[model samples]
Target: MSENKNKSGVGMKRSGGMGGGPMGSFAGPIVKAKDFKGTLKRLLGYLKPQRVKFIIVFIFAIMSTIFTIVGPKISGNAITRLVEGMIAKYTAISQNTALLKSGKDAVIPIPSIDFPYIGNIILLLLGLYLISALFGFLQQYIMAGVAQKTVYNLRKEVEDKLSRLPLKFFDARTHGEILSRVTNDVDNISTTLQQSLTQLITSIVTIIGVIIMMLTISPLMTLVVILTLPLYVAITAFVAKHSQKYFAAQQKEIGELNGHVEEMYTGHKIIKAFGREHDSIKKFENINDRLYNAGWKAQFISGIIMPMMRFVSNIGYVVVCVAGGYLATQGRISIGDIQAFIQYSSQFTQPIVQTANIANIIQSTVASAERVFELLDEIEELPDTTNAKLIEFPKGEVKFENVDFSYKSEESLIKNMNIDVKQGHTIAIVGPTGAGKTTLVNLLMRFYEIGAGSITIDGVDIRDIKRGELHNMFGMVLQDTWLFNGTIMENIAYGKKGATEEEVMKAARAAHAHHFIKTLPDGYNTILNEEASNISQGQKQLLTIARAILANPTIMILDEATSSVDSRTEVYIQRAMTELMQNRTSFVIAHRLSTIRDAELILVMNKGSIIEMGNHNELLDKNGFYADLYNSQFTGANLDNEVI
Candidate 1:
């Protein structure tokens, strides 16, 4: 029986598991780069508002590229000039010797040339180089500034969209995956955006300028260089297309790994109690293997790009030398021109290779962009209406009329449920496992919308009210208590910002938690570990109650509030709850029937429908579902328990 029960509990659809669809099960591994062009254009559109800064940066980039192009040209010219001067001197000497040998020794005149032009050319080249360096730095500085700003706003926008999304969105994504997008993926975009644009623009411009210069010097050589470009471009595109899919997959796998590890560590005690260490290890290894394979695949494709490009570049060099040398020997091109063409070919090939190499980063950036935008484009489940207005709670009356709900559309969790609680009334919902108690609470809070019918507060539909204002009217404590890592003061103050220390203590006292807290070394100043794991379960629940009490809401919903405590602690909590719910509308869902005898209405539900409804004794007389549950939960108990 115990084994069957455990199996059933494990099979209970694990809450907060990823939903919607399976991840990374595409027919083909790579998503085409063309598919993302529109997203890239949309991202670039964000720069429109900063057009002035963009233009300034553009101007600097052009200037830098011009200087970069000029550097190779100047150096090529210097080489040609030096070669020409040597040839000229050698030719002069040969002619003078021939004149002397021919016995026409009439003092051979040597060609004298102007020197200022050569000096001016050399000086011009130096000046252009210095200017290029200055503009390069300026361009990089401005672009980096813009990239940081763009990323900052982009992250802020994603965060805002996430905040507006309904709870179901979070239910479908792991916390680590979402965090990676907001932090890791966003950081990748910023880093790549900062450096890639400036480098890409400069390399492209420089490559174009060098090719044009080569064409003017020797069109044949230029054609040869152009022929080699297609092969490099094709290879880069292919590798990038494949690498991007793996890169995106790699990121997703890392997120899954993080989430899996977090779950294992957080629930280590439970796993140990069940002796599931080997099982957990196998599970972890599977996720880790997927991550490792994805990472290696991405890096392998990226690694191939540079070496392949360089090999193609070398082929271009061999072709240029053969073609250019033939032209120079045929007297169709001067030696100086041939040398200059060779220099320009090298210049042209280097940028193409560099661009091909950097394409890896560009692909990764695009992949990150795709992931980020995918999140931004997610259709929020239940967006609040634009015209929704705030409706203040008069007396905290709540009613559900013919309500129906389904967590997933195929199966209903709540079915045609009708419930009403008057102002200042206490209602208890008792049901077998898998009944709709939690679903009812979810609908009440509007975390999800009902499939049919409506929920109202004081006769006004909840949908007609702003969600924020509607939720502000109630305080809730769930079965599993969650506390963030923070000082006790911060956690309690989360209920009401600007709550005084005295008010915090008052609420803590009201929850019957003050005595234990005071015994701690630092009291309110003591820091809690993640999930407050160091604290006892009773203490955690009490702290949760203190938070709700501090909010001072008109309506309170407590689900299994004292389920994890000892009898003494349960009694203490019960007393505190009595005081907290005095003259306030309240709802309780508890397995402990003794906890709700005083409730004005007690509902006994099974499957997805209510089977019984009444006050305590009236239901006991009926000898139905409610009576059976009450007797089973309170039989042979202390005499006080029977009365309670």
Candidate 2:
């Protein structure tokens, strides 16, 4: 994995894999023939579970093809019988007239064929039609069910993969793009499989049936029909190849467009505050333009396919009509035979057109499949290790041993860092904006890996411990708190699934959030919107703290937990924090040095290196980085309110 070399900050870590060169460095987007084969193999693998339904539907399709062929033939037979009967009746009248004019009683021999035979053939044609229609419905229903079920399973698998993947994956990619894959791309696959696969199957079957019936009627005529096949194949193949590329490009642009839309909505407040609505519109237009052009190209190519196929089919029909007429005129074949040959030839070309339509669908589907496979193939960070086991962190002793880390190989964010927290101790980490303070906690949480050294819990390497077992020990309260769109009670209980109502209320009370929650009309049942935007930042943080407290983890990490609250709320929050940290291993990062004056250990960091370390007053007495920072910044920050 390649890391970003040209960035710096405490929270500058990439979200997915380690930074690497361009993902498709050696191979480009054009899928090779072998690649297509591999994709088809995987797609077919999804069908294993639906094999029984597949076999049933396929058998019905074959029966439907037979009925389709038989129905047209019976129609031709009915027409032939009606025509022959009319001709025979007319000849008899002519002969009778000639005999009577010669002064003799004309005796015309009447053909003994039953006229109702034509009606029976017509009835038989209707029966065949009914059969075809029934099977068509069966095939459609079964195929649609298979497609939907396949898509459901596929989406679930991708969602699970996303959850298991490291946070870094989300950092590099836009949420909209990922959403596009799961929703839009998967929908495309469903449409293609349900609709196109059915048509393709029927077309292939029709092609075979037509050839067999045509050859049985006239080999020469069948050969003439076969001659037109190459033209349809050439046109469809050319259009399919071109259309696939454009379709793939179009889908890619759609993902990009979706990404932009999601970003715009997510940052709408920022854009409006800065009066950048026009700028957002222009940016959206740029992506919309790309999507439009790609769509236009794909549609243009796909449109040409049907017209071109119909033209070739028309030419084949003409050839069969002219040749069949000539054969009938010369008495080389019966009128019924000639008629059947023409009908068969026409029927044969229908599949060619059907095949062309299926080609368009397959092209579009392949594009979506490619995008979905790309995400599934992504490398996950922090793969589970063999022999990893859960650890018993009864005391929550955290120790950092000569830890070093960087967002990229070319930049080092933390150098030879070391820290340790005893059971039930509070350690304060104070630093400038880019001094790797947050990066330290990120490593300890195993959000990112250390370039050198290790983080240990209860004297065991965290990397050697199961991720869930290790993370279950700590509860984090971030400065920017996030609450889902749910009731207050539900949000608090989210930290501990299946938590009782009483437990949630007690945690809320402990965090000093119960009073405000009680004032709301819905109280603990009040539903929040996205990110809890309806509530004040302080309330949100307190709710989050309540959630963390409800989890009852052995270790607690507070990142500027009280920064958003007012001075009046800050004291209450401080008291809550003190109570929460008591008898629990705690790490605090604060801009206000006064908040950490009673901390058991204080580490002052500068440029990824710890410049001073001791208890709060001991470092202040030393008059080093800690003293300079406190006197210049935090000391003057709260003096007016006497917050210290």
Candidate 3:
């Protein structure tokens, strides 16, 4: 399965691996990142460009919070004024005379209720809120831009990294594992940056500002807030520490589940053919149950933080309320300041509640950030030398000079292999599976560099040639054909950049594909489904051949190109291959010896050595490994003759 399915463009590598495993690794509880702080610091480095914008946002956030903080104090003053005015009015009416304005130092006995004063104060309060709202809106708007731009760049970086990653990376991991990093992990970072980042900043500022406001109002009341602080810290720390593991476990299970689903969906035909639907369902149930256990545990654990914080906060609120009322009676604090201080204390706990909630979010974000960074830190393919020359025109004179290689150091697969092919010569490589045929192809193509010596093209070391120019010299038709979900014409045209319709038709005719293609519902305009499953395997192979033919390269690689076709169709394909290989160097890797019997040079390989080399008759007379392989195809006839 491929991590990313071939869309129109981008991320086009084929993925490898089966899904699921025993109860270990992913099944184990989630562990912390090895360098949590480093991962977070690196994650923030992506947003470094938005530093100035964030600063502005921070300033606006503080303005909004400060405005909100003072609103309660103003409200308290308005209430106090109302009480004093009502008392003075009652006193004046009892004296049976018009209320008089007293001296500057004396109290003003109210003649009428001070409605205008209260209204003015109310308007002032509204004005402060309006300013807060304006700044708050600006803060969110700026952060939104900052968050989006940051993730956009991060996505681009990951895409570029995927393109540079070595094949070995894909070989070791599943499509699900890679896809999880791209989709789930990147998305987690995106969500945290966009939603939680601004909220976190605001929460911290609000907590600090509220603390200062409460202290300024009354030191005695501040002590009450201080008393309840330890309980809040203890509850938050304990719950957060325990919930972190479950959140990490949840992410891992989700990846496993995704991997299993992608595997099952792509291989449903094979599963049904084998009548393993029940077994597949059972496997799915196992994964799904694990996910449920991990997910709910994470959710349940994080779920307790808010309620627990609210419980702790409520207890503090009750204590402050009692303390404030008593202080008001003792005249140590005015009723207005007492009211303001209580409101300050209430707002203070909210940010604490928010911070606690954000801590759980941060736990998940860190787990995901670590996954994303791992992909970013993957070892890239060695870069080409700065002065690597471009292959202006390839002559197709290829040589493997004492080349040695292995997928691992302990196990040598190919050793001291040497072969030479002149320009325009046809070289047929015949071997069984795992005989290093594909490995040899990969070396020649520079997909895997030789461990010793060199593979050269036209006397130029391939490593010294730029990879893009090297690839352009050859056309390939592999055993497994790849066709995107597009019209048949588009798939055929993919081999050559901007190929004309006439050229596509001509190539198709040469490959004997034009006849069947014309018989289809819409001819070349027919759209292939994903996986090209709507067409037969032979038809897909024919399309791939047509694509390679359209390229008109100086070198060709055909890896079992006709294996899927019937004998009748194979004849046409062989003829097409003969014509395509004319005056061009071609490397044909085939298991069927009969197809390549007429080749100019046959390199018969077993294990990784060319044990026999000759034309058909020459190899047959040798009676070596090559002859035995060719003769084994007719064992039934031999058995019949012996019995007679």
Q: Evaluated with lDDT, which candidate comes out highest? A: 3
List the candidate 2 regions with Cα displacement exceeding 4 Å: 1-34, 48-57, 101-103, 109-113, 133-160, 181-193, 219-312, 334-346, 356-393, 406-413, 449-452, 592-594, 632-644
The C-alpha RMSD of each candidate to the native structure, in angstroms, is 7.1, 7.2, 6.5
Best by TM-score: 3
lDDT of 2 by residue, 377-486 (tens): 88876776899967654688989989989887998889998888899999999987888788788888898888999889888899988788878888999998989988
Query: What value does the lDDT take at residue 434 in candidate 1?
Result: 82
lDDT, candidate 2, equals 0.77
- Local distance difference test, per candidate? 0.77, 0.77, 0.79
65-85, model 1: which lDDT tens digit per residue?
Answer: 887676655666666666677
Would you list the rank order by TM-score, best first?
Answer: 3, 2, 1
TM-score for all models, in order of appearance: 0.80, 0.80, 0.85
Clashing pairs in 3: none
**Which runs of model 3 end up more than 4 angstroms from their true locations?**
1-31, 86-113, 241-257, 283-301, 357-377, 636-644
Q: Total clashing residue pairs per candidate?
A: 0, 8, 0
- The Cα error of candidate 1 at residue 13, in Å, is 27
